[model samples]
Target: MLDANLSTQLKGYLEKLTQPIELAASLDDGAKSAELESLLQEIASLSGKIAYVRKDDDARKPSFAINRVGSDIGVRFAGIPMGHEFTSLVLALLQVGGHPSKASQDVIEQVRTLRGTGSDGVLRFETYFSLSCQNCPDVVQALNLMSVLNPSIQHVAIDGGLFQQEVEARQVMAVPTVFLNGELFESGRMSLEQIVAKLDTGAADREADKIRHKDSFDVLVVGGGPAGAAAAVYAARKGIRTGVAAERFGGQVLDTMSIENFISVPHTEGPKMAAALEQHVREYDVDIMNLQRAQKLIPAREPGGLIEVQLANGASLKSRTVVVSTGARWRQMNVPGEEQYRNKGVAYCPHCDGPLFKGKRVAVIGGGNSGVEAAIDLAGIVNHVTLIEFDSQLRADDVLQRKLRSLDNVTVITSGQTTEVLGDGHKVNGLVYRDRLGGDSHRIELEGVFVQIGLLPNTEWLKGTLALSPRGEIEIDAYGRTSLPGVFAAGDATTVPYKQIVIAMGEGSKAALSAFDHLIRTSAPVEAAVAA
Candidate 1:
């Protein structure tokens, strides 16, 4: 079922296999099993170094194992690898076939050390994931790479849809839910260091006390997304004490897909861009506090006073200035069934989840740039796409509208108000909407729904502390200065008109410069001289 172009690409990637690899599959005689077997055979046929075999394993009827010939590295998939996870399967094969992991040497050594340390038993990592989760691939790949690095550490990615019973039993409410040795480890994207730390501690507290000591900095950044990373880097370049406090480094950017509007770069993905951002910030002397979320911000009492920033982990930071760039998160549709079927089929990211609905009908909510873009993109992957817009006309660009019109499989519906998401108890089946003009209700049968509404700033914690607009965005001046002295804001969290990465970076730089200027003007002659 691979397309010609995809088949050609797979062939090119398969040619890099340095050693022979064997794929052992145990599948019952059924249509789904037959399709999976055929796909595996096709993949094996692409290279001389790869082969497939059928086996009888009653415990895991539809499971498949990939191993280096004559080596005991056991890497297996318990379900059919399709959708976005198809890339995971490809990467696993390549990794098992002698390709080295992209993880840092430090991380690799840590994994090795973890394996060498007297283990209670085989450390099992069961990651529950959905095909549409943008963050799932990274977690799956990280665990899988660790498994390849050390055989004693086993990793299994269980598709939440296929294994609903286990998901409910474990109370997995989110995708990329990781369970270590049958206990919940983490619920979202976690760095390798964080994972290792979690394993080492094995504490029952999900939010373990991480920060122990009070920290101080000249300029403190309160986020770790593109904007905050840029702010930290810019502040550190001035040779000041810079610290960045982040719940997670990437923020909403981690949920983004292929980015074509990042200025100089012709094309890049979210994970790649996030890594570059982190690496760039690490090149400087900035102290990065990952997994530390700002719980409250207390501005300095005096002009030259130090601002105290409280963290979720009970740690506090005192800084001369604080730049708020906590960024924004995907706005959720509060309609019923939306939350119930979140990962079960109601998805926010078209790029991450579209492939899961391949050859199936799906609907795109909203008619703005994101919605139109999602519909257009999903049209190429799914059987049919319905673009729903609440407005009378589409708010997308002319070029985008023209391109969308050219797509035969896409149907655009304006003045359509989504009322409720319809779903079977286990997964999404369809949705109901009302025609604003006629006041008539209608329902469409589809397997998936992509919500591309807009973004809501992550500034709830700053409420009543910072000057925020009615919509909850931080109000800032042209110079990125907030109402509170020694406090600045930027990025989507601020009143910035555009929310693009490039724009956020520029805004972050402006905020950093503004903070530096404030410091220089307010300091004593000796301190000012030193800063200058």
Candidate 2:
């Protein structure tokens, strides 16, 4: 029978294995080597105990009625178990038993060789991932195979959804993420070749620089919207290292149309504004990445204390400070084909892909101001534009509704809800609908469908990473700073009530300025020290 104390002892051993190592360069080589040897010995002792438990279980479960393989190292997972990581549990149990065959032994040795020879001992790597990720299964399988090849490699898989609280505490933005020696490694799926490359460094090179800092900057903006855009243009023209990653790069201007509100610009569309903004930012060589959701902000541990911004993409960027022009998706259509065909044929904004369907029939599926506006725009480019509505009257302002009605090619279909999208392999071809009043069914033939029903902040992905408003927007102060000190947000995703282009643009500028201020106060000392 398996002893009760075995599981407890194993747990204690694993706790030691995963504890983070604090390094001081000034420490003598004897102390450093001693520390490394201690870590390796702890791992070896744990491995031996786990083997004993596995053999004991095999002898006890003779009937095979309840052949349960147990591990002493246990952590609650957050998510579902259906992903590429499903087999990881079984493999981990197998390794703990110590009955691995000769081939398995060879494989394990090879994996060790690949990791490198070191007196400092084994590094424990545990990864957490979700089944929803299509690419996660491949990653899990590769990791499993690697573990079988080398018993020195300790592997643990955690279901992301199951460990919700733990994930939030760690500020995990995406999966699959590997935590090595208690520090976050890479996120997202990586191939076996990539994994090998990551671990193939020499012992001396394995210790990565834990911090980087910078000092002083010319222009620091707080947002990435119109005002932020204008600020970035000015800053880049002055020529210093400037970079911007917003919740979105385009800001609210990308969601607008007929921008007669802007001075001297006459009538302009959201895409046109976004394009101009993109051109302006790029012309001055400002680094920009859209869809880069910022997570936490912390001062660099190094001298000079530059701020470090972590991203959902598992990337860390250091800047003097930042701009906060991250924007939001308009409320979603919440309809069936909306998610599946997003950026395929069903789009939220017309300006981004409208010209691609020039002269083709399309449907604008909403009655809101944005919906009516999209219908008018599509009518100008396509052979026909069908505006479908579930409500009796259009919700757009009188002026906007009248303009939509006046458009020659636009037809408003009322009291109708989109039932299903009709498509083949490539793109959306048509949609089936039902009339709410009379139970009548109809179908429209179109090449594209634009959903303008409403907007939802893309903040859902920021769960646990940032404090969000009850309505799902990123909550920010008047200065555009979020609850997090070094991070800021702007545009429609913020609690900014007006979903207008002009407002978002101004908010972006505000965010950029806040970020700049934060960096200036934090970065200079660190950069100077690094240079010294």
Point out where model 1 deviates above 4 Å: 1-74, 77-123, 126-134, 148-152, 157-190, 193-210, 524-532
* TM per prediction: 0.78, 0.47
What overall lDDT, based on C-alpha atoms, would model 2 receive against the true structure? Answer: 0.57
lDDT of 1 by residue, 1-532 (tens): 6888988999999888887999988888776678778888999999999999988563555668888999877577767777768888889999999988777686687787664234565778888777766678888888888888887788888776666666666655466778877777777677676776566554213333444454567899999998899899888888888899888898878888778988889987787789889999999988887777789999898888899888876668888999999999888879999988886778777765555566789999988888898998889888999999999999999999999999999999999999999987877889999999999999999988889999999999999899899999999999999989999998999998978899999999999989988888886322432655
Evaluate model 2: give its TM-score: 0.47
Clashing pairs in 1: none
By summed lDDT, which 10 consecutive residues of candidate 2 come out lowest? 59-68
Q: In order, how many clashes per candidate?
A: 0, 45
Please report, in order, the local distance difference test score of every candidate based on alpha carbons.
0.83, 0.57
Error of 1 at 65 (Å): 4.7
Which candidate leads in TM-score? 1
